[model samples]
Target: MAKVLVLYYSAFGHIETLANAVAEGARGAGAEVDVKRVPEPPRPAHHAQAGQSAPVAEIGDLASYDAIIVGTGTRFGRMSGPMASFLDQGGGLWAKGALNGKVGAAFTSTGTQHGGQETTLFSIITNLLHFGMVIVGLDYGFQGQMTTSEIVGGAPYGATTIAGGDGSRQPSAIELDGARYQGRRVAEVAQKLHG
Candidate 1:
């Protein structure tokens, strides 16, 4: 069976919820999904200096997986520091081309309609490119849109979530579909490549 890793970091549980939806999509598409959270770094003292990176979970070998799907919440229109730090830890793998030729994609949650959802997705994808992974995005032609309308999570770029301004809204139907679609697409590509 093909394996797809759904790795992410969540500060307020929104991104974590989105990650589960992404895994659901991957599972629906017939792939074994491994969902892992990036561990947070120790919080600095209240009086400590700013601009500190958070703690993250140690990732094991990616060589065993067929693909990887990274997730994060938008922070200043980019992926969160925890998620970025997690990617940084993959340098050794990147140096050796361990992720080369594998399928890859990204997803994100925004606190508002214009909270840089696409940009966060792009930021993660940019890192994936350096790892030599084949990037995949949701196609505009997917048929599961009516279940949830007016939301843009189902992008040709990747899965996404608006999450509303107050960050109280749950994942919309369209966003859920988008996540699943991307997961399934990733699995399909991986199967084809490794078949």
Candidate 2:
């Protein structure tokens, strides 16, 4: 079976919700999936990471996955600090090309409709590219992203959702579906590559 990891850092639970949808899609596609969250900072014990039920991920373990799907809340149109720091720690894997030929994808949540969702996805995609991983995204097949009838969040870069400015909004149903499609796409790519 293709081993897929869904790694995320969610504040306000938006990304966490989407992460589960992604994992569900991957599992449905017959991939063995593990979902993990990034470690929190040492001093701030009250942050979202502390209350998360998912186990914290080990940087070294990332290399073993055939595919990795990353999700984070956008910080100024980029990935959150914890996620950026976590990926930055994978220098050893980059040096050895351990992730080369592996599948990589990204997802994110934003506080507003125009809040840098695509940019954040690209920021994550850039890191994956540096590790020589193949990129899979929320392709056009998802269709929900193209709908203008509702306020949906998704892009060719990856899946995404809009959280209201005060973080009151949860991911819409279409957004979750987009996440699932992206996850399934990544798993399918990994299966083709590894099988």
- Largest lDDT belongs to which candidate? 2
Any residue pairs clashing in model 1, and if so which? 25-180, 39-57, 40-55, 41-54, 41-55
Model 2 has a clash total of 0
Candidate number of the best TM-score: 2
Residue 20, model 1: Cα distance from true site in angstroms: 1.4
**Model 2 scores what on Cα lDDT?**
0.93
Question: What tens-digit string does per-residue lDDT give for candidate 2 at 11-87?
Answer: 77999999999999999999999999998765532345347788999999899999999999999989989899999
Q: Candidates' TM-scores?
A: 0.86, 0.96
Give the C-alpha lDDT of model 1: 0.77
lDDT of each: 0.77, 0.93
